[model samples]
Target: MSNEQENPLLQYIFNNPEEFARNLTKIAENSGKALAAYLEPRESGRVQDETPEELSLAVKTLAQVGEYWMKDPARAIEAQTRLWTGYMHVWNNTLKRMAGEDSAPTITPAPGDKRFRDAEWEENQFFDFVKQMYLQTTQWAEHLVEGATDVDEHTRHKAAFYVRQITNAMAPSNFILTNPELLRETMTSNGENLVKGMEMLAEDIKAGNGEVKLRQSDPSSFEIGKNVANTPGKVIAQNDVCQLIQYEPQTEQVYKRPILVVPPWINKYYILDLNEEKSFIRWMVEQGHTVFVISWVNPDERQSQKSFEHYMQEGIFMALDTIQKTTQQSTVNAIGYCVGGTLLAIALAYMAKTGQKDRVATVTFLTTQVDFVHSGDLRVFVDEEQIKLLEDRMNKQGYLDGSKMATAFNMLRSNDLIWPYVINNYIRGKEPFPFDLLFWNSDATRLPAANHSFYLRNCYLTNNLAKGELEIDGIKIDLKDVEIPVYNLATREDHIAPAISVLEGSHCFGGPVEYVLAGSGHIAGVVNPPHKNKYQYWTNDGLHRDINDWLNTAEEHPGSWWPHWQEWITDKDNTLVKARKPGARRVKILEDAPGSYVKVRL
Candidate 1:
């Protein structure tokens, strides 16, 4: 018998044909059920029909794009020919190498392309061909996406994204045969790495409730207070939803108006207070600002019912009241990061509608989006079907698990976040290095189901927040009603909150709005300190409706935007006073900074 026929499992299956048939039948039945579930349309009243006017507009847009592309048919043919020629050269080189040629034509990886970095991939002719072919395929796919004119911009973008994902997934480095490092280790260790990987996989499956958990690092390697959120502070106030942390002043004197930082609950609050060097909180404190951050509690089933209104009231409102009372300052300057910025804007609107606009002196938004129309790739996951699936999962768990949410974000940059860790941990049998940022990233926090659902539906899906249709606590909050001077900071490379979307939202406010575009992605842009002397920023006094017009006219400023922000905040008021301690008369110290709420693990 042949090797395949002699296999014990195969022989048994062949002999017990009825049993094999039964198993196949069961598999088919399960697959059909899964397919049915996936195709099922969600029940949502917000979904609109494709009207003739909308269809006409879409058709016109497609035609315009098509006409532009078809203006030069020869150009398209030339590009395709070039790609074909490159593929042919690669195939010829591969065949030559197979015929035992000493030298083979190989393409070098692009700058910063870490995949195919293994010596075997670079030296081995087979792997060299595989890498070159993959690169060529990716280039061709991207060219096709760029050339496509039959679809809308969003559709084209999604197609490109999926194409990249498929190409990345099929990279030779992910396989055992093409992965030199993995092969070397397997031979040296006599397949021990495989056994260890299996063990780890089993352990993770058990711990993660059947989910395949790709551990970024050894969780025990880092602790909350010691290496991570080590900044000195005290929790002066606490509520059901969050705890207010008041960091000890570094300088003798601080700004007269205390700064209240509202961070997104989607992540742990300590991201701002990470380490002293990279910590924005530390930098702000050293810059003579009395900073108070809201540490949102890691919600459990009990807090799943907490609504968006509850977060605004019990979180931001409570913190603001505490800061005002403690510092004895009627108005405090507020800075909001990410979703926290969105919440702050809502609060400002609510306060304005309620005739309490003076509660905040000035507002600063760090990569926040109120206008969801151009919110970037995250919109792909906000549709009715996806939202329904997410809602159902959240309903079952009472809250959205941090890992589950992280998966969606990680998929946005799968090449960077997912594949590297997979190769290092499982394929190469190595643990990820103890990086604080990665550690913090892995330590995600859960979102309360009610609040998350409301946010996804109202803000992202319907985009009521920017339109002033968002109502909270029996009050209609309008962004135009917010008369407070706003400092809107957006990152050029931000995927979550696009700068254009931020610019649109900034225009919604009926006040003096200064929009600044900083370099780098979301987190790095906001946390950047001036001393690092990294990442330039752009600014313009003119407020133009067109984003490109503003970008074209804006003056480029070197280094970090921190100094500019400091100057802006300082210009707000000339009053400076001795720095106040962590807790004041009204708000006594409860616990040290970083706070208990931030340390909670879901």
Candidate 2:
């Protein structure tokens, strides 16, 4: 008569007790491996203990906001009352909906919320109540943070960020008991999913050497050079910092100016060369460009002494020298993405200081920042308190582990990146589908101590580059001195480099800037190809204004901005030259395309 009895788990448990017991035993064994995977590294002293500052920073930041409410009794009581009111409404709605009144939800999930996609989160009374309660509780939490206005700007941002992390971890969708889809699967499989999931947990822990490296895609399904980054090219030259690869030309006659790509070292350059369909590098080659990309080395203790000056001198500048020799050209067009763009901007200033500004004829900055005034949430983790802690950790190994940066980026979009994997892989015991972008995302690279430290201190911490206070190799470089034509691109919904920050950087430049806005976030927006036509782009209506002002009068174009970029680049210099091979002129071919450097995995 009872629902539990009628829908009994493992309906034939009495007959299938043998298989059930075997699965339970497997789970127990796998759980032991996971524990051992975490402890063995510490026992052997292979991994050092990190400072407690990381944990304390979150606590202290939250305390600042808590102190705001504690100072006023009315504020504290009002927050509690607000929470209780929301709970009461959720309860009332649950009762009405249970009685078949079609009662509307007390609060709805945000537009793109994928958590409540299951019909049971709404059609079923119990699950619906749980979903509404979670939404209401999130609203209450948001109210508490918003009301703490007395908190300083940075501290408040950190508190709100911490709150979101805590709330995301507590979402009901993360647990099998609270998630309808997970619960149904658990019961249907008689808990075999839990056993397999435990096995996976142990594997990931072992792979990370005591940390959990959640598998975002089926790793077995993809390889870097074979599937994901398989573009036709050859490595022309290599140094300690990077290897320069020149793609085989797709067109008989290519643009005279060779394009050298300076990609961020935080992640692999394959993001721009994902696959045939999504390959931005391949697309550029097809657009009659002789594409050359610098594949930065994954750092180690050997590169501990490498600084920002060294990266400019060895990485970007070295690639520029090689590009000139390989293409037999005096000048080249340059493209810089993210942090790489920042370096190119610095190099431009340095070039101007040395009277060599014409080395790179025209430049393009893709989601790069010279000013950090409006730098997004990443700033919350870059304060003196945290950077000091980070430096201390880096001193132990000479390089910041790639995973540390990767984890921080994921935290920015925890609901989409972290929780979803926790549910699908750990709870549902299903492997995620093969996705090129996520595969590239998981492939992170280490950051050398000197380079990372100087960057954080100068750019993120001090905003020196914008103020002309940045000194490189004992030279005070100025952006205004290097007045070359620039094509500045910013993604509309970027979390790392916000459009406003990119817009502000446009003002810092002393040249004519052709600013364009693309729809989507950092990666997707930049990598979009014209044929795919996935997203739209906006160009200013021949007026120079701020982001908001420009958006109001911008000309919206359908599809990717690649075609427009091709047109813009060619108009500058449409002269055609015979397609150049990887090592036709001077630089000797060192290796095949994608290079040995990118094949080095973390």
Candidate 3:
């Protein structure tokens, strides 16, 4: 064979040596400049001096895993043996492929694992071997963590989570050399991709003030009021904690009982109103239901002392009062998403204890958790040590930076959320397409110190709400007392609020509970509009203790939960009243919404 035929890379370089060298120089030049962006912050004292709190936690957690494994050398050695044997199989397979023989992969990516979805991962022998070996190593490490019986559950959970994050970061696809697509791009562009990537890295580091603010979507494409959260509403009431938005009526008549949607303060409410077609808020209004949503303020040091109770007082209570005055309705139907649902549950219990049970006639919880005993991996960060460290950090800023919470959430599904962005934005040198959901995701809100601290200690750490031990304003509130009708929705594939956790939490409600399971994660499952008819939900007349049992007997239905929810809520009282305008009676319109609160960027 000719020398050029022996190596395609050499042939390409031989054809365009000057271009190749220029690209290499560009890559080297930009690589050094990226560091300057990061270092500038340190020089100005903008970056903190101490070690990251998460790194410390990971080290401590991994130590426990090591301790457990070291106690049983035989088991540890066996795990190593399994890994080596797997590697040997991959080695033999790669050898066979090189010799022009067909060889099946030793291991493959798990179902729904998108990381290796690229065709090159399975089609190319070299990439296949690399993928299989990595999978085996990850599986072995996971099994080792699982076998660490001596390690406590909390330690084990942390170790497992930390390990996944590390493995994800170290994935073959993350690096240009191992990633076939990235490699092809680099060669074709003559290393220009790396230069562009480095420039982006520097800009991102500057954007995050020393941390990589991984851009998930083109932020320039969408504006809060212009495109997202544009469901035609007016902010009629305002408080320190939230802005009460009353959407304009789309139908001539609406249900007698208005729906007050209390979305989690952690995320902007636009997820439900990404656009007119997908907007749950728009659909609700179209279905002849008066809908009002709480737009939580992006808090700062001034709002640091805002406790959980204050959110209820200034958020839900204030909205409810506004709804009553506007429509002259005695009661309202309540909808709470995620943490907002938990707060609503607490508020309902408090109201019942204080003899104000008539204010909220019915309650619907979307991906909400009252009981946190099995709250999944989020509980790993709730222990005394981490919480104290977190509290101290929050104290310094008077509120936890929204980015920290955003990063923690992204960690839960790091492969889906984190690594993809890293590869696309940092390695491939590509800007992501405009995605509304991702834009809203990047728009994070600060958590007040007192509120966050109380929530962590009470709900996540102690499980007080489920135990009937949670107190509000010196009153011990019991969920058993707030026995109005309940519609509890849990998403099937939710990482933030697991279906099992939601099922377990249903036991806390004293009312006749109708538990429904929706397909997809926390956001998509709930925001699914009937128009799109994407995903499915399950309904069971009975609430079973085990989630599997509930699923086994449940009736599966196609389409969104919004229509199902509409049917359920309206079934209680379908009395038609003339649709009321924003700030109808007593209240005055503060401003047109997607309100100023929703527009506040951290």
Candidate 4:
């Protein structure tokens, strides 16, 4: 008992060995009595046979216990003690079950699960130690209940509450909270480190370069011509995200027909034209679609006065006006991504509500959500208190900081992007690898505090979008009122905008909604063109249907959904005409391919 004092449960088990042994004797006596009754059979045609070997074994067991039986007084005392101990064990176990807590199984103390003799030995020792401790504690608890001096209805209830409280106090959660070392290790591991290191690197780069890099116009990987800006037919349209260079045939000109690309102000529009290999915008240009992307101005403190109504008017509606005038086309195919998609949906709804849908011929939404309910975990950070705090902070600064927006995104993948780099670069003196995606991820945009707060509270927190209760510029917007041909793309692995949540948009839209499920997260899914490693999509029969029904018939395929999308768009427009420019009489060229608004710094 002294040696076992290090573990209280083990000490209890050791101190009660006699009582345990006595219980074994009692169980044996009960077994013998049952066997003797079985040996007696009523007079009938049926014969109950007892094996000689079994009868001999039972007789031998009874003979051994006969000595204890003769010492009746001592044996009776021991049996009573064992019964009390068993009762204690049952009571403790009942309390544990009610608490919904688990006693974790023992684990081997090694670097990994690799097996060796020492590992096996350690595993056995750990499990044995835990098992012994559990049995002793259970027995002690059971014994107390069985030996209660005053047992009545009220007393029993009081005892039960005490047992539960004791069980809870001794629960495993206490150990978890006290383990700071484990918490430190977990928070500092994996992708978290990369994000933190990338953040620092982004700051250094932004400080040195002043503005994020915009790739010069380039042709799609699938295009036959070179993507060089100086190339004969290399058409350049620069935005803050990147420079989209289009290579069209000498005969195929963009001065005739136009295609408008609308991206959310939250992110740069370059996702459509990330690079020649992966750029969807580049592919459309090569496929003879006159691509006109909206290069959103990166807002700053000066633009803090800009409101949601301004974004729709100056940002999207203005772009549409320019595209229409430049191309001399009455309507254009407008594709929006993320927040841009939400904006596009708003514009489409506005057009529908106003009894006007002619300017926009086709609309596509990439990972956009109309319903607030399925907005996923992004809702966590947009509660009333958080929104108010952000509004106050942003109002002071005029616009929400770009780096701050990036911080929120990195928090979503903290284990993958924040703390790991904090430990490696800040704590461990390690240099991070320069990854292109990380660089792109670090490039963020600013939003007006008033606008951002309104969006978070009205769209996400309140879910006014799907309810047809969303108001833009004092005008109630209803998506169902819109009769435009709509295309919605959702990614399966998008944590920011989950597929389940994004699908709500299809239901909210009154138009012919074609919802497609793409592969990968938000960015990769949309940027994925018809490349070898690209993923496939699932769609219904071009009719608006429930999400589950579409999934049931949806087969998984590989490569991007862009090709399928292009086919769908082409089918809507059967006539092939030369690409045209915005032919408005009074509109003047504002800037080069990419605009100045995208270049503003924090």
Scored against the true structure, residue 111 in model 3 reaches a CA lDDT of 93
Number of the predicted model whose lDDT against the real structure is largest: 2
Ordered from best to worst lDDT, the candidate numbers read 2, 3, 1, 4
* Model 2 TM-score, 2 decimals: 0.96
Residues 242-360 of candidate 4 have per-residue lDDT tens digits of 23322333335433445667777776665555556766766777777777667666776767877777777776676665555555677878888887788788888888777668888
Q: Write the per-residue lDDT of candidate 3 for residues 221-272, one digit (tens) a residue.
A: 9988888888898999998899999999999988889999999998888888
lDDT (tens digit, per residue) of candidate 2 on 1-602? 86546764433233455776888898899899999998999899897656466778888988888888888999888888899999999999988877778777899999999988987788667778888898899888877777788888888888889999988898888887778788877766767888888888888999999889988988888987899889999998888999999999989999999999999999899999999988989999998999999999999999998999999999988888888777778689999999999999999999999978889889999999989999998998888888898898888889999999999999999988888987778777888888888989999899999899999999999999999999998999888876888999999999999999998888887888888999999999999988787899999845454677889889999999988988889989989988888888767889898999998878
- Write down the RMSD of all candidates, one decimal each: 9.4, 2.4, 2.1, 23.9
Where does candidate 4 stray beyond 4 Å?
1-257, 427-430, 542-549, 581-587
- TM-scores for all candidates: the values are 0.82, 0.96, 0.96, 0.61
Residue-pair clash count for candidate 2: 0
lDDT (CA) per prediction: 0.80, 0.88, 0.88, 0.58
List candidate 2 stretches off by more than 4 Å: 1-21, 542-545
For model 1, what is the error of residue 218's alpha carbon versus the real structure, in angstroms, after optimal superposition? 3.4
User: What C-alpha lDDT, on a 0 to 100 scale, does residue 27 get in candidate 4?
Assistant: 44
Model 4 worst lDDT window (10 residues): 215-224
Clashes of 4: 43
Report the error of model 4 at residue 26, Å. Answer: 74
Worst 10 residues of 1 by lDDT: 41-50
Residue 314 miss distance in model 4 (angstroms): 0.4
Question: What would the per-residue lDDT of candidate 1 be over residues 1-602, giving only the tens digit for each residue?
Answer: 78534652232123444554554554455445433433332223222222354345434544554455566788667666878888998898888777877655545677888886766675566668878888887887677667776656765765666666777888877876666666555554555455455555545544554455667778878899888888888899999899999888888888899999999998887788778788888888988999999999899898889998999999999998888788888899999999999989999999988878899989999999999999898876676756786787778768988877787788788888888877776556566788777787877889999999989988899999888799889887889998878999999999999989999898899899999999999888877878889999999999888889999999999889988998999899858898899767767888887778888874
Clashes of each: 1, 0, 0, 43
